[model samples]
Target: MKPSRLARDAIVLRRAPFSETSQVVDLLTPDDGRLSVLARGSYRDKSTFGGPLDVLTRGVADVQRRKRSELDLLHGFKITQPWRGLRRELTTWLAASHALELVRAFAWPRDREPALFDALAGVLELLDRARERYEIEAYLTSFAGRVLAIAGFVPVLDACVRCGGDVADAKRGWLSLAQGGLLCGSCSTPDRTAIVCSDGVVRLLRRALGGAPDATPGTAWTETVVSEARRAIDLYVEYRLERPLLSRRLLDRAERSPSREPVA
Candidate 1:
């Protein structure tokens, strides 16, 4: 008997050539989590998969899971949001790529994570409309915070992860990647792997974790705040995932280029 067909709203996370005419695609879906599907003849001119099957393409996929195999056969795909705006800007493209990479790494296959699916969709739209590098950075930071929260690894921003002391009342805080939260000055030690952060940086991180994605803040983020928040979030995520992401390394390289837009 043939495997039953399943359809779900999916966002393409990664796609690579398989053979001369086929491609292997990884997709994230609300109902199905992450899926690996084989797109037969997807690279051909008369292929049913029209347009580009690029990363971050939101679409519906018709697929069938083989009886004894992990890979699914992709019957068809229909694009819903191509995110054309990201393609126009290099920074936006990198930002979207970073988000997709994180999703692919952290999200488990066949596990239902509807909230993460919604967050990725929302972040993609935000990246598509972002006008500045700082904005994209803010969105990426926010996206990371949300994804971590969904994965049950949210860093403690309001209190010390070690002592459970309030961070708001402290003059300075330390971000402990291993402890997985902010550490008050009194609770921190030289031996701990921690990043010293200012009160403003703590506040920004708190807001990023708890605030809505589209809500504009009452105060603008200074260059220091942006840099500090990015570092703290990146370190925390890398610690939780136990490895650094390639997309993040690429983003760092791009930012170091003389021709790249000034993040500050």
Candidate 2:
């Protein structure tokens, strides 16, 4: 029996050539979560996919799912938002890539994640307009924080994870990755596996984790605040995921390389 064809709005996450004229594509859809589809003859010049089927392309994917196989057949793709702005800047492009990598890592196939999909779409649209490196970093951090919370890994920032004491008024605290949140001064000891955190960092984390997915904070973050926020989020994510991300390494390399003119 032939499987029924399904169509859904999807964002391309990753793609690779599978054969001389075919490709394997990873996509994130609101209803389907993360999916792998085989696009036959997509490499051909007059392929039915119509436009370039690259990462970050938002489109409607027509897929035919087999009853016993994990890979689905992609009949066609109709592009909606190509996100052309991302191609104009290296930082923004890399930032978007990093976000997609996180989704690919954490999102499960066939899991319903409409909220996660909306959050990702919101962040990508913001990244398209971000002008500074700091803005890009801030947005990426925000995206990570939100996604982590959506995945049930919400970090404790309002109070001590260990003792439940309010640390909102405290001057300093400790971020414990193993404990999955902040620890008050009373609960944090010298031997604890934690990172010393300032009140400012805690506040930033609180906002990032709990703020609306479409909201960008108006606070002006100093280089120190930006660095600390990024470090904290990265460390927490790595600890939870049990490994570092490849896209993060690439992003670090790009940051260290010679500077280029800011994207207009």
Candidate 3:
């Protein structure tokens, strides 16, 4: 009888050496959420993969499912969308890499969330097409914010999270991690760990929480607003996740130096 097998369209999020010839690949799928699969003997003279299973490459995967606790077997992976444009520039590559990292961070193993896959797909397309660093950064920031919002971990912004007072009319508000949202002037405390955001930033944040449809090509945000949003979201994500994203830090350093050459 033919062996039982399945196929999924997936993106290679990460890959690590398994046993010299084999590898373990982490993938994000629209239907399967995240899956870690063992590619046994992929280095052999006759391999079944359609192409080299590189990171950020979207492809169809042939897999064998075993026990939930065990790694799935990657029978073959065939590339469909290489997203080669992502490799042409430094920011674009970093942005795509960062998106993958963020996906892996929030998406649980073998849990399905199609929205997550679509969001990542959208951001990758945006990053690949955008030539401007500013535009790329905007898309990246939007993706990060949307990721937080989609996962239902974002703090409240409409009212003071502490006192439940209206902040809609306020010129600006502070996001208190402790309070789980924005804080009105009366509730703001000096000792609290919080992020200060202007009304413009708040508006953008609000738009972001509803999902990031506005992140499309024709949409726009000022550099200032984008910067503020990026800073706030990065801090909030790091605090919530309990560790900093290494890709984010590398991008930050690269962006600060106008004369410095990009490594990628």
lDDT of 2 by residue, 4-30 (tens): 788889999999999888899998999
Worst 10 residues of 1 by lDDT: 255-264
Pick out the ten consecutive residues of candidate 2 with the lowest summed lDDT.
Answer: 211-220
lDDT tens digits by residue: candidate 1, 114-223: 99999999999988888777777778877887887788777888777888887887767898888888887777885377988887778778877775453233357776
**Candidate 3 lowest-lDDT run of ten:** 255-264
Model 3, span 14-111: residue lDDT tens: 99888878889999999889999998877666778733468888889998877754699998888889888888767677778889888888999888
> Which ranges in model 1 have alpha carbons more than 4 Å from their true place?
1-3, 214-219, 258-264
Clashes per model (N, Cα, C within 3 A)? 0, 0, 0
TM, every model = 0.90, 0.90, 0.91
Clashing pairs in 1: none
Look at candidate 3 and give me any clashing residue pairs. Answer: none
Q: Whose TM-score is higher: candidate 1's or candidate 3's?
A: 3
Cα miss at 51, model 2 (Å)? 5.7
Give the top-scoring candidate (lDDT): 2
Error of 3 at 216 (Å): 4.8
